[model samples]
Target: MKNVIITGTSRGIGFEMVKLFSEAGHNVLALSRNSKPVSDLKLKNVTALEFDIANEPEVVNLSAYLQKAMKTVDVLINNAGFLVNKPFAEITAEEFKRSYGVNVFGVASLIKTALPFMKTDGHVVNISSMGGIQGSVKFPGLSAYSSSKGAVITLTELLAEEYKETGPSFNVLALGSVQTEMLEEAFPGFKAPLSATEMAEYILDFSLSGNKFYNGKILQVSSTTP
Candidate 1:
């Protein structure tokens, strides 16, 4: 019965999450640059919107949509991410900017927009990567991607602290490799331990109830090392 907002819903985890939430009888606003996939699903409770989080104007439009279609958001999952797999020495400034634009800045802007529409019981979940965790296992050619995700983890903590009294808990999840198209695109032939649906189901449950016990924390949901 809750209104949920999910970004990066064109495919993979975000796509599965939309279906899961809708099947669970919740309303979902699925946002992705390419909305056709979700739109084609035609779920009664899911509304797919063509969204580019990297675009500030689109974020403002999202705010307007929230005001018109939903009075409040029960869950805001910042699942949209941009990854640039390039060696640090060779990574360009534009590449870094594109990475941060979607992974960090977009998450921040979306969270800020959602804050006014979020209640005390709402949750804001920022999706990060195990590579983003300090002291965790690192991967080569992920300087821009991993660093931006790291920034999101820190940003989540600060936001949680700033709005502790007002409520709407903020948390970040540092996930291990999942068998997603993003993974395949980034690293061909690599197989992850979990599937997109499995990971999506875990995240769906956490988004609904994790705020009750945790906030301003980074939960590494990985079978991998620290």
Candidate 2:
């Protein structure tokens, strides 16, 4: 019934969000570098758009396209990310920039363009990693990824405060490892405790309810049992 926009919809958690939201009867604007996954879904409620999230031009184009098609966006999930698991000493400046380009700058650009179309009481959920949290799970070589996510958390907090009078709420979710391509690439040989579908389900609930009372929160999501 509501309009939702999701980034990184080509696979993993973003893909699952597309499926979940579409099935829940929401109009979903699914953005990804590769549009095949969402195109293949052939859902009536889902519209797939292919674009480079890290590219400002592409993000701007997407925003214009959506503005023409949708009157208001009820939820915006900034889930697209890039991960580089290299030793801090080995990580080049270029590598760090690439990671931030996608994980941070891309997210900010999308938000800037989409804010105009966001509905009142809308929710903006920035997907971050648990590694970004001060005392959450830490990996050996995820410095770039963790730091980018940490920045996202800070950005979310500042936006929430800056837009307190505005109807839309901003919050960040620090997620534990989930079974996804990004996870496998970041932590080779390690098994994740949660599935993308599980995480998407939990996120869907929060996207609808979390804004009621909470904003600017860094929510750490993980399994209830070990």
Candidate 3:
């Protein structure tokens, strides 16, 4: 069984991934700002870590903790992210910085910390959004969020290329409006979004396939393909 590290596991998509992976017999390290409410099924091989991903000290401590734990991670899911749904004109500098801090910098920090423990066949999945792929007319308030996700997509591609010769695979999954708390916070009444469980299953399947053909590319999963 693979040992996986998943961020943003307090709720939504990350939580679902932790549950699914644990049930599939994978050792899961679930990290979030708050402690995850434990379920009976998660007690077997799931370890929940509570820390702020945006805090450099916390991330450093996490790295040291992992080193002491002596468990090599087979996969790292860069799933912790934040969104600010405000128009560009009204967006504050602090808001933009906060968004980037969590969405971009946090991922980079975690990857750096986890890279040493990753084996040759390891996988890294950066969860991006369809907004990162193309301009969104429907969500003009999400300029900051979209731009941050776009950066994640670019980083994912660059890392994939950098690791191409190194054997480990990296890819970006540009999800199309998955129904999660983040989505609800962004667009409260939005309909037709893919469910969290659906997206989790898709991610699990993709990661287990051992396919590197989609490396460095943004893979979009949506309810309605256009």
Candidate 4:
């Protein structure tokens, strides 16, 4: 069984992933700001951690846990995201900072902390959004959120190149609209074609095998735009 670390595991896709990976007999470290949901499940081989990527102390705590509990890292899925839907003109500097803090900087921090424990066959999957793709459907209120995701795409490519001689392949996924609580919060009354479990299954499969075929690539996993 592989040792997998998945962020944003409180609900939605991340929550579903915890189940899928656990059922597949993988050791999963599920991290989220509120990890009670997964903690409540009390699944075998799954550790629910109350984590906030934007918090430095929490990142350090995660590093300690990884070093102490999990000797090696097999799969690290940066599924945590932060979105602020506000008009561009009305967007505040702090809002953009917070978005970037979680969506971009937080991801980089985790990778740095986890890289030491990752081997050549390890995989790092960073999750982005379809709206982050340039020239895709642009939404007015997501300037901060989408742009931050775009940054993650570029970051993934750079890391892959830097680690070419090393190990741990990195890839990013620009997902299309998935019917998640985040989507519901962003756009109420809008129904997405794919459910959380459906997307989770796809992601679980990819996180395990996608690295063999592609690295430093961005896969668009959405059939519809939100």
Runs of candidate 1 with Cα error greater than 4 angstroms are none
Model 2 vs truth, CA RMSD: 1.7
RMSD list, candidates in order: 1.0, 1.7, 2.0, 0.9
For candidate 2, lDDT tens digit of each residue in 52-125? 88998998887668768997898999999999988899999999998999999999999988898876699999
Question: Clashes in candidate 2: how many?
Answer: 0
Q: For residues 1-226, could you state the per-residue lDDT of candidate 3 as single tens digits?
A: 8888889988888888888998899888888887646443456789888878899999988878888874698888888889988889999999999999999999989998888888778888898887777654346787788889989999988988898877468888888877888878877887645788888888887876634566777887665521
Better of 1 and 2 by lDDT: 1
Q: Rate residue 222 of model 3 by lDDT.
A: 60
- Which runs of model 2 end up more than 4 angstroms from their true locations? 224-226
Candidate 2, after superposition: displacement of residue 213 in Å?
2.1
Give the TM-score comparing model 4 with the true structure, all chains together.
Answer: 0.98
Query: TM-scores across all candidates?
Result: 0.98, 0.95, 0.93, 0.98
Model 1 residue 49 CA deviation in Å: 0.4
Global CA lDDT computed for model 3 = 0.82
